[model samples]
Target: MPKDTMTAEQRLQTVIRLGVPDRVPVDPMIYYFAAYYANITVHELWSDMKKYEFAINKCFNELGPWDIYYPINPISPEAYMFILPMKMKLAGLDLPPDEINQVIEEEIMSADEYLTFARSKTPTTFLKYINFLSTLACRVQREQQGEGIFAKTRIIRKMLKQIPVWREEFKRWQARDVAVQHGICMEAPFDTLSMSRGLVSFSYDLMDNPGPLAEVSLALSKGYVKVGDWLTKKTGVRRVLVFCHRTSNDFVSPKQFEQHAFPSLKAIVNGFVERGVTPFLHCDGNWNKNLEYLYELPKGKVVLQFDGRTDIFRAKEIIGGHCCIFGDVPASMLAFGGKEEVTEYCKKLIEKAGKGGGFILAAGCEVAPNARPENVKAMLDSVKKFGYYS
Candidate 1:
C-alpha cells in the first residue's frame, strides 16, 4: 500500500489552505451513531462523562482511521446555552434514552432586552444581562431550572468543570491519530437573537422593528473575538464552529439577510481570522444564494459545511476556490440506503467537489442516530478508493 505523505493534522491544514493534500480529508460527523455502534445508551452518556469519552474513543479506534473528529460530546448541555441561550431538552430526561436533543424556543429575551445585550459587546456582560437560557437544563440535574440575573450563574461553574473533561477528550482523539474539530463553537448573532425571541416574535421584530435588531446583531459581532479567545483559552484548540442554521437564504429574504445578518456574519468570520482561529461554518439550510457572499471572508482559512440542504456541487463551482468545503453526504442515505448507494454518492462528491484541493468529505449533517454501520464505513471506504492525489 502507498503510504500517506501527511499527518491528519497536516492533511486538514493543507485542505483549509486550499492546497492539495495526500487525499481528500474525511470528517465523518459521527455523533449519536457512535454511541449506538459502541453499545452505549444515550442515558449513560448523559450521566457519565467518562463513558461518553470512552464511547467516542472506541468508535474511532474500532471503526478505524477517521481524520477530523467533531466529538460533539453528549454530556455538556450548557456548552450551547452560552451562545443560543435557548433551552435544549436532551435525551435521558423527559425524552427517551436514545433520542436526540431538542431545542424548546420561546420568547425568553424580550424586545425590551435587546438594548442591554447589544451594549457591552462582551459575552461576560451580555450573558450576565441575559442570565442564561430560557428553558435551562443540566444533564447532571436531569430537570428544568431557572437562573436569575447575576454577576455569575451556576452554568459557569458547570462549564469550568467541563473544561478539564473536554481537554482529555481532545487528547484521546489525538491519540487515535484523528484531528479534533472545533474546540469551541459559535452561532451567527441573528440566529441567536431570532431563536431567543421565538420565531413568531422574531418575525414581528423583523417587520415591525428593524433598527434595534440590526444594532444589537452588529454590536454582538464585535464580541466574537473575545468569545473565541476565551473558548480557545479553555479548550487549547484553535478551530471554532460558527454554526448558521437560521440566517441562511432558506430562512430569510436576501434583502433582510443583507441588512440584518450579513454584517454580523462578516464581522464574526473575519474576527476569528484576525485572531488566527479557523472558523468551521456548520451551515444547516439552503445557502445557495449566500455562497456568493462568502468569498469576502479570508480565503483558505474558513470551512463551509452544509447539511445536504444547499447545492454543494454548485457551492464547489462558487466558493470552492475561495474557501475549503466540507460535507453534504445526505443523512437519509446513510440510514436507509445500502453500502453501494452510499459509495456512489460519495464517489460523485469525491469526483466533483473533491476535484480540487479544498474539500473534506463528511455527512450532510450529523450522522443520523440510526445510520447503517456498513454505510458509515462505506463513506470512509470511498475516500481511500477514490480520494488520492498525485
Candidate 2:
C-alpha cells in the first residue's frame, strides 16, 4: 500500500457521502484488457500481483484518467474442471492458455468423484477453471456444439470459496491507495448461483425446484457472510462493489428475478449493511423491468451501477437519493464511435444523473478490450469536463 495512493475506504466513503473525489472513480473490471495491453496473459498477470499492479498503473497512466482502479483476479479454474473451454478475443487479441490442475478436474465432478479430487490439493484448480471458461466464451462465434462443456457442478462450489481470495487481492490494491472494486460479484448469493449454473437453468430451478434451490440459497448466504466478513476484516474497508454483469432484467423475466434472484440477493445485501459495509450492485443491462426491485434492496445498503441499457434518468428518478448510482455510458458507443459521441453520451449521463451528488461517471460496463485507446481517454476526459455540479 502506497502512503500516497488513495485507499478504497476513503474513495467509497466519499462517494457515498456524495462528495466528489479528486477525480471520478474508474473502477473497471480490466483483468483481460489491462493484461493484453501490457503484453501479458491474464493467468500470469493474476498469479503475479506485481505484474497486475504494474499493468493497471500503466493502463491508468497511458489510458486513464480514472480515480478508482480494479486489480484483476485470474478466473478460477474449478469452473472448467470437467469441460472443454474457449475465449473471447476481439479483432487482434492474443493470449496463451494456462493449465488447470488434475485435482480441480476431480473436485468439480459429481459427488462420486470427490474422493479422487481430495487426494491432491493444488492452485491449478483455480487456474484451470478460469482458463477453461475463458476459452469457452471466446469460442462463441466459432460453434455451438461445445457451448456448455464448462458447466460442471461441484467445481463451481469450490470456485465460490475463491471469492475471499479475490477480495483479499482487491484489498491489496486498496492498501496501495488505488481503491479497487471486486469484479462482478462477491456479496450477492443469487448472482453467485446464477454464475455457477448459468442464468437459464438457475431461473428455471427457482421456479421448478424452489425447495432445493432455496436450500442452496441459504447455504450460499452463509458463504457470502464468510466472504464478506473476510473482506471487511482483512481489508478493513467499509464499501464493497459487486458487479452484476449477467443477472439483469434483459437476461430474464421480472417474475423470474423476483422468484430466483431477489430473495438471496436481499439476504446478502442486508448482511453487508448490518455489518455497516456499503454495497454497490453493477447491473449492466436494461433494468427498467425491475428498477423498483433494485430499490427494494436494503435502502442505502446498495448502490446502483447501471449499464447502457438502463435509462439513467429513470434510475435517478427511482433511487437517486435512496441510493448512489454509478455508470451508464455505452461500451459500443465508446468503442466504435467518436469523441463527440463519447462526449455527448457522457454529457447526457451526467446531465440526467449528476444533478444530485450521488452519481458516478463510468462505463455502463467495462471499457471494451478493442476500444480505441483514444476513445477511452475521451470517455474519461468527458467525465472530468462534464461531470461537475455546476
Candidate 3:
C-alpha cells in the first residue's frame, strides 16, 4: 500500500506488515504523555477526557506519528497501576499499626468477592472501595519489592454465573459507540483476585486450589471474549492490545506461567481470532523466557508491545514475522537521552526490525508522565528521517 493511500487503520496494518512508510509510525502508549503535554496532573487525566483529548492532539500534531491509542476510558482502567490490592488504616482508626492491621484484616473480603463484584447488576459503592484497596496494595508491593507481586498472589475465582452481568454492561458500552475500540480488556481479573485475597495467600492457592484457579481464569476469558466480540461488532475495531504487568517473564518461570496463566490467555486470543479480531499482547519485562509459547499463536495475527526489559533484537528475530512487534524506545531513555540518542536508537531499530514487515514503533510501554516534549520530537523526527522504504 502506498503511504499516501493509507487510512489511519491501514497505515497501522502496513507497519504491522513490516512495510516501511513515508515515516515510522509514532504510537506512544500515551497516558502520562497526555498529562505532561496538557500540563495537568495524573488525577485530572483520569477524570477529564476533554483535557486528555487536548493532550493527545498536542502530542499527535507536534509529533506526527501513526495511529493514537485514543483511550476508551479515562486513562486505561485495565492497567495494573490503577488496580492494586492493599489495605491501609483509614483515618481515625486510632490503633497501633499492628492492632489497626488486625481490625482491617478481619474485614478482608473473601475470593468470592471477585465474582460478586463482577456479577453486580449495578456497581456498588463497596465494589469501588475494594477496587481502591486493590490499587493501593499493588502500588505498595511494587514500591517495597521493586517488582510487581500480584502475579504470585492469590485470587478468588468466581463461578461462571457471575460473569453474564458484566458482559451485559459491555454490550451497553458497545451499543453506545463509546469508542471505536474497547480495550483488550474491560478490567483485570487476576488483579481483582489479588485484592480479595492477599498476594502470599493467593500464590499458595495456585498450588492448593489449582482447580478453582483454572476455573476462574477460564471464566474471566469468557467475559473478555464477549466484550471483544461486542467491541468488534460495534466499531469494527477488531484489533486489540491486551496488557499484563505481573505476569512478565521476569516474574514467572515458564513452567509456572504456562500452567497458571497461558491456558486462559490462549483461550482469549484464540477466541478473538476465531471471531476475526486481532489479539495484541501487551507484556512488559523479559519475554525471552516464553518465546516458544508466544510463537505458538498464529503468525501475523497478533501484536506484541514490549517494555524496555524485553530484548527487542531477539524478539524481532523470533516473532517479528508472525506478529507485529512494537516498542523498545524506553520512556526513561527518552526522558533523559535527548534528541541525538533517541534518533540513533530509532534508526537502529528500523534497520534491524523493519525488515520483511510486521513492526511498529512505540515506547516500551507508555510515554511516562514526565517524558520531555523534545524527546518525543526526537522519536518522530528519526522515524520520518529514516523510516521510508525505497
* Cα TM-score per model: 0.92, 0.70, 0.71
Off by over 4 Å in 3: 1-5, 17-23, 70-72, 75-184, 187-196, 207-209
Better of 1 and 2 by TM-score: 1
Cand. 2 TM to true fold: 0.70
Q: Please write out the lDDT profile of model 2 over residues 88-115, one tens digit for every residue.
A: 2322223333321111111111222222
Better of 1 and 3 by lDDT: 1
Error of 1 at 386 (Å): 0.8
CA shift at 376, candidate 2, in angstroms? 1.0
Q: Could you tell me which residue pairs clash in candidate 1?
A: none
lDDT of each: 0.78, 0.57, 0.59
lDDT of 3 by residue, 159-266 (tens): 122234334444543453222223334333453454446656666666666555545655567656666566455544566657565566665577767886777778
Give the Å shift of residue 16 in candidate 2: 1.8
Residue 219 lDDT, candidate 1, scale 0-100: 73
Top-TM-score structure, candidate number: 1
Clashes (backbone N, CA, C under 3 Å), per candidate, total 0, 20, 17
Report how far residue 350 has shifted in candidate 2, in Å. Answer: 1.7
Return whichever of 1 and 2 wins on lDDT.
1
TM-score of 1: 0.92
Off by over 4 Å in 2: 1-11, 18-29, 75-177, 182-187, 198-200, 243-246
